[model samples]
Target: MQDQFDLDVFGNYLFIFCGGSRNKYNALHWDGDGFILLYKRLKSGVIQVIQWPRSREDLRMVSQQELRWLLEGLSIEQPKAIKKAKTGYFH
Candidate 1:
């Protein structure tokens, strides 16, 4: 992101990601005065990597709630839960 994206292009957006399970997340935002970089590491477990939409557009907008979920280590692209059969049989 640092190499591919520039302040001019990404200044209005926020970046969120972790290097992996052992690394902390890096969140970058642009304030009127300057850029604000936030780093957070959980005591245990890792932040969930967001599954971005498969789109042709270069930019996408994320809602505050979705952002909150992302920060909380949850998948913003949760798949719908599937129901099991009514039969009460087990192996």
Candidate 2:
């Protein structure tokens, strides 16, 4: 049970699982002090999972930095876009 999620109030987390099939995945969630579950599947194709480190296996504990990287598709090897200030949130 490898997970990439944040425990911070402003951060989100994701859970990775390998149960269903090649086209689907399950994400058990953590809502603040509680737990929840989320599921995802490709509508017209299969989902691809990247190779993760073969060490961390606890879902309840994941780093915020790692979760940020996963959710934003940002990594050391990839060229990430310049982060600009968020605007136009409301009208």
Candidate 3:
């Protein structure tokens, strides 16, 4: 992640995952004073796929709730109920 992203170019938030038995998760951010790098590794479980963007040009937007779930070792993608439109013909 450090090699791939720069704060001035990419923005303040970045997340990186190192997959394996010794899985690692990294987050980089810019504080007023300097850069703050956070790292976490699960002792027993692996972090589910963060679903990174498919291409270099593509971007993935994650909600605060989703980010919280990820840090808790939970799946970010979950099924949600679809609201049906109120039954009335459009004039």
Candidate 4:
């Protein structure tokens, strides 16, 4: 995974999903000193298929709200949602 995505560049949290059944997910996070790995499996439902980038060259960054939408089985692209304003611009 590191070969494809730069773990260090992703700040702290990196979410990975399995291929076959797509029923499992792993979250890797850096907690200052060490790394923490969290795994989760659904007993009943499967997570929605996300439109992930096809190649390593097609990298895209997601916002916190987009991540929340993804975790909630919703598409990350929300047209109706208000865009987050840029910080440090107002007095």
Residue-wise C-alpha lDDT for candidate 1, range 1-91, written one tens digit per residue: 5445433534577866467463368888878788889988777766665444333254466667667867777755556634346797778
Off by over 4 Å in 1: 2-10, 50-59, 79-91
Q: Compared to the true structure, candidate 4 yields what TM-score? A: 0.61
Provide TM-scores for the models.
Answer: 0.61, 0.40, 0.62, 0.61
lDDT of each residue in 1-91, candidate 3, tens digit only: 4345322524566555545553567776766677778888877777776565544455566777777867777777756724346898977
Q: What is the C-alpha RMSD of each candidate to the true structure, in Å?
A: 9.7, 9.2, 5.2, 3.9
Scored by CA lDDT, what does every candidate get? 0.63, 0.49, 0.63, 0.66
Better of 1 and 2 by lDDT: 1
lDDT of 3: 0.63
Where does model 4 exceed 4 Å of error?
Answer: 6-13, 43-45, 85-91
For candidate 2, lDDT tens digit of each residue in 4-70? 3323422355555644454556665677777676655555554433554355442334456544444
lDDT score, residue 80, model 4?
95
Q: With candidate 2 superimposed using the best TM-score fit, by how many Å does residue 28's alpha carbon deviate from the native? A: 1.9
lDDT of 4: 0.66
Worst 10 residues of 4 by lDDT: 9-18
Can you list the residue pairs that collide in candidate 3? none
> What are the per-model numbers of colliding residue pairs?
0, 1, 0, 0
